[model samples]
Target: MRMVQKPSSVVLASLKPSTYTNRTPRAGTLPAHRLAGVSKPDAPYSSRRAPRCGLVGRTFSPFTIVLLVILGGVVATAAQEDERATVEPTLARRAATLILARCAVCHTTDLIVQQRLPEDRWTATVEKMVHWGADLTKDEAAVLLQYLTARYHPGAPDHLPSIENELAMTEPLRGQTTATDGPLTGLAARGAGLYAHNCQACHGEGAVGGVGPKLARNTILKNDGVFWETVLHGRGPMPAWGSVLSHQDIADIHAWLATR
Candidate 1:
C-alpha cells in the first residue's frame, strides 16, 4: 500500500478558519475546551455515586434539627387544645339550639355568653322573657334553663376560689337584726318545702349557716330588689338560680327566708 504524505506546515497554515470549524464532533464524543488559543483534551466525566442506603455518611444539620423539634412541639400543643374543647352533651346541644333560635332574636350570643347566672336567675329571666312574649313553650323553657345553668352557672368550678374568698371576707357581724325578721306569712309558709328541697344543702337547714353564710338576719333581705337581684344574679360564692326557679317560686322562697 502506498503511504500518504503529511501536509506541510505552510500548506496547513493557508487553510481557512472555517475548515476547522466545519468539523463535526464524533458520535458519543464531547468537544474539546480551548483557552488562550490552546486546545485542551476532553476529560472523562464521572458522576457522583449515591451514598449507600442514602444516609450512610450523612449528618443532620443544626437548622434541620431545630426545625424538626419545633414541628413536634406545635403538633403536641394542637392536640391538647383539641382535647380541651370537646362538644357538649345531647341535652346541652338541644338547649343551645333553642337558645340560638329564641334568644338571638333580641340578644347577642356574646351577651348570653358573658352572663354566669345561677339556675334560679336563669329561671326568672326566662319567665320574664315569656311574660314579654318570647313565645317559648314550657318544655322549651325547661331545656333552655338546663343548658344555661349547666354551662354558665356562677358556681362553676373556675369561679369557685375567687367567689369563696370574697364571700368569706365579707361575712356580716353577728347579732345584726335583718329585714327577714319582719312579719312574713302565707306564700312564705308555702315556700318552706321548696326551700328545704332547693336551698337547705348549701344554705343550712334553718338558713343559719353551712357552705353558704347564714341567711337569717342577713343584710341582703333589707331591700326586695336587692334580695331578688342577689338570688337571681348571684353574689360572691352564691350561684344565681334565676333559670331554675320560677318568679313565683323565688318570691315564695323570699317570703319564706323573711320568716326564717
Candidate 2:
C-alpha cells in the first residue's frame, strides 16, 4: 500500500469555523451554539420574544387569579337563579289552570281567592274538597296544595273582595221580568236542551239541586220577575247569563225550569 500525504496548511486555514458557522442549519439538525448551550455573537437582535401557550406559559398575580375565579362563580350562580325564576312561574301557571278546571266546578273563583289560611288549613280544605267529589289525582292535589299555600297563605295580601261583602252591597232585584216572557207550553221542549247545556252542571239533573239551591218546587219559579233578575244578574256564586244568553234563551230556560 502507498502512504497518504497530509493536507496543506492553507487548505486547513481556508476551512475555518467561521465558514460553516454563518451557513443555514440542515433539516432535523441542531445548531452548534444551541446544542452546546451557547449563543451566537453576530446573530440578529430582537426585542420581541417567542409566543407562549396554555395556562402554564401565562403569568398572573394571585389577586387577579382570585378575582377571575370569583367572577366566574358569580356568573354561574346568576344563571342558576334565572333558571329557578323561569321554572317557578311555569309551575304557578300550571297550578292555576288545575284550580280553574277542577275547583271551579262546585264553587266560584271568588270564593277560593278570598280565603287566607295556613298550609295545614289549606291541606284540610283540599282533602275535604277531594272527599266531596273533586276529580283530582294525587300529583294534581299536591301541586294544587303547593299553589294554594303559596298564594293564599296567612301572610299573603288580601286583594280579592269578599263574597259576603259583595252580596251585602247589592240590592235584590224585585219583579224584574224580561219582555220575551210568554206562555210556557210550546217552548218547554226547546228550553229542556238549553237548560241541560247551560244550567245543569251546577243546578243538578232535573233542577233537584247539587251545588246550587234545589229548583224543584221552588217558589222562585212561580214568580217570573225574580227568576228573570236572578238569571240575568248573577247571585252569590252564580255567573250573570245576560251577557251569554239572549232574552229568548233565558225565557226558554225559565219555561223548562217551570215544568221541572
Candidate 3:
C-alpha cells in the first residue's frame, strides 16, 4: 500500500496572514463624494427634502378668522335697524282721538289750525266756540287755544318734542268767522290780497274788464240782490266765490270793489 505525500513547505507558508501583501485587490474602492450621494441621517433635513411638499398652508387660519368676524358684525347691525323701523309710531291715531272727543261737536280741528291768529285772537275765538255750544271747560279752552295759536302763528315750540302728531286743523270755526274773527281785518286791506289771488287775472288788476266783465263797473252792483245773484251764478268764466268766501269776507271784498 502507498500513502499520499505532504504539500511543499512554500505552499503551506503562502496561506499565512501577511504572505500576500504585494497582491492587487480585484474591486476598486469608492471616493467620499460617491458614498455621500446615497448616505442619509435617520430623519430627513427640512432644507433638503423638496421642502416636504408644503400642503400645510400657513395663511389659511388667519384668513378664516377675519372672514367670520366681518360676517358677524353685518348681521348684528341689520338686526338693530329692523327693530327700530318695526316699532315707529303713527300720528293719525293719537291726535285724531283727542280732536274728535274734545272739539268736534261745534268746531273741527280743521277750522282751528288753518287760521293764523295771535294768542289774543285765539282767546276770543275760544269764547266764540263756547258760545257756539262747544263743551270745553275754561282750562281746556285755554290749552286748546294756546296749542292752536302756537302751532300755526309764527314760532318754534319752546321745547323740542320727541314725537310727531298730525292734525288736519285749519281755519277758525267755519260758521262764525268774520273780518275781526279771521286773521286780517277791513274790506280794502282784505280784498286787495283776495282779488290778486282770485279775480285779477280775469277781471284786470282792479276789476277793469278783461276776460270777464268789470265786477265793480258793471250795473249789477247797483242792485244788491242782482249783485249777489251774479256773484253766485258766476255769469262767465269766473267761478262762484260766494260759497267759498266767508260772508264777511264776501261783503268786505264787495265793499272794496265798489271803490275800484
Best by lDDT: 2
**Shift in Å, residue 110, candidate 1:** 19
- Could you estimate the TM-score for every candidate? 0.33, 0.36, 0.29
| Residue 187 lDDT in candidate 2 | 73
Give me the runs in candidate 2 sitting further than 4 Å from their true place. Answer: 1-105, 111-186
lDDT of 1 by residue, 1-260 (tens): 11122212112222222221122222233222211223334335312323311234568643343344345435433432332122133444345545544564455355666665656788898899889866467777766665565445442222222322322333333332223344444388767887885667568988997877888888777787787777665566555454445566677887888887
Q: Over the stretch 97-180, how does candidate 3's per-residue lDDT look in tens digits? A: 334434543344456445544566767877886787665556455445534433433222222222112322321234422223
Candidate 2, 194: how far from true, in Å?
Answer: 1.3
Worst 10 residues of 2 by lDDT: 1-10
Model 3 stretches astray by more than 4 angstroms: 1-186
Can you list the residue pairs that collide in candidate 2?
none
Assess candidate 1 and give its TM-score to the true structure.
0.33
Error of 1 at 40 (Å): 52
